[model samples]
Target: MSTGELSDERVTAAVRDATAAPSMHNTQPWRFRYLRSEGVFQVRADFGRALPHADPDGRALHISCGAALLNLRVALAHRGLRPVARLLPDPGDPALLAVVRPSRPEDGGEGGGGEGGLGALHPAVHRRHTSRLPFTETEIPQALRTALSDAARREGALLDFPGPSHLRWVLQLVEEAEARNRTDRGEAEDLARWTRAGTAGTSDAAGAAAAGDGIPEYAFGPRRFDGRAPVRDFAGTGRVSGRRAATFERHPQVALLSTVKDRPEDWLRAGQAMERVLLLATLEGLVGSPATQPVEWPDLRWPLRDPVSGRGQVQTVLRLGYGPSGPGTPRRPTGEVLDIRP
Candidate 1:
């Protein structure tokens, strides 16, 4: 674990772990290059996969890349390597989201150091899936909530669990955004391009497909028979084999992840914090799904803030509870998304 240099096989393994991070519609909008001479991992944005209508400003794209970066860090830490990461390291190249170098020194088990904690979260990287099914009404323990909040704070972001009144208002904003998304031709086209009612991978099975990326029908959880969990319905009215309708929790537990500033760098940080919290949640025996409906719209985004304090700008809506973990969707092969320099 103390070995400073990484072999090509180890680098490939790290990139595989990084690609496991979730993205909007499973676009996997990220690329990685291992500079062998510099001993650095460069995380870049793949603009070719950008969702023009859903994320015109590339905020979500940056966030997705940040999530991948977090996974890469975790992978390195699990191997007892110190990952010193910098966000937006280069001013000249906007596509370079992050540059991570493995420091030579071993991380002491000191409380202040991040390496120990990140290594602890290594198992959750592959286990954490975006669960869209119904969750039990049982409340999450206060200690667990605090832990999740701390995870977010560690990456310079805030996790707010709204009260009943504020949650109702937030739900209203989601409904409004969903309504707008249904009527907007641009959004519909975007969804159609990234979602598949039949197999999304290459196979011809019902929920299976040959494609390496995109949301597969098998991963669509189930239809919300009668709850306001705010889960995105990828199927819409489209048909999928063996899809079922199920009742969800009456008062689903949700949380809002936000940042103090609304900038590109802030979005990138939020993405890392989002993944951190999610991985911690998974470790604590929780399953979750992301609902970005209100956050995606300019008009509704402002109202999503705390009604009284009006503090941070919300970036992600998370639904968490005890539920079945959704099936994993295929990722673009590591060879396709990674390049190794001589």
Candidate 2:
């Protein structure tokens, strides 16, 4: 892992590991073009992969890229290589998310980097799935919640879980957000573009279709949204006209991850933190899903502010509980996402 001498082959293998990071919809809105001569892996945000109506300014695009960058770091470290990364390396090129170079080489070591219970958790990388399904009434251990909060803090973000008293208000916000999205013509169209079953490899706006990324119909749970746990219904797309409805976890534990300031860098940081929290949850044998419908609306955005902290905008709303982990969503191969420019 020398900055002066990086191989495209080795970088390709690393890029494979980086795609494990999660985004709003498993959009995988990122591309890595490696400059062999410079030994820099240029991480670029694929605007085409973005949900234009949902993320007009490409904030989510940057977050997804940031998550990939975090994965790149972990992948390199897992191989005993510390990659030198410059976030938003070129302001002139806005799509340029980061440039990574395999530097500070070392022997991968005797299972030292990934130690403790986390060592076991590392394997969850391949097992982690964004389950759009509901959880059984099975309760989650309180200890695991502590671990999740710790994981978020490790990446410079905080979690705010609402108490029973605040549940009614929180649900109000979620309802308001849902209502707004239902009427928002642009968002509905954008979702339709991304959620089509035929998008797998043929449809023009197949979005994550070819990549085998994004939520699939099998995982969309029920078309009907049960008020019990408050899960995000991707069924809103209306593509699957008729789908079975299942009983979800009675009380799905929902939490918000946020930063003190709302900015591109902050979103990136929050995204990285979100990935860690998710992986940690996966390690604990739990499933996590996202609900951005509320955060996407201006009217419902600031209302999610935690009463205690009284700061930071809610970047993500997650439903965490014990349930069967999701399936392996599709992804673009290493070659498609990683470019080696000699």
74-137, model 1: which lDDT tens digit per residue?
A: 8887776778889888899988989998764454731112533787888899999998888889
Tens-place lDDT digits, model 2, residues 148-187: 8777776678887778766567777887877777778887
User: Lowest summed-lDDT stretch of 10 residues in model 1?
Assistant: 107-116
> Which stretches of model 1 miss by more than 4 angstroms?
1-4, 105-116, 200-209
Q: How well does candidate 1 score on lDDT at residue 143?
A: 84
Give each model's whole-structure lDDT: 0.85, 0.71
Provide C-alpha RMSD values for all models, in order.
Answer: 2.3, 3.7
Residue 251 of model 1: what lDDT? 89
TM-scores of all predicted structures:
0.94, 0.87
Best by TM-score: 1
lDDT of 2: 0.71
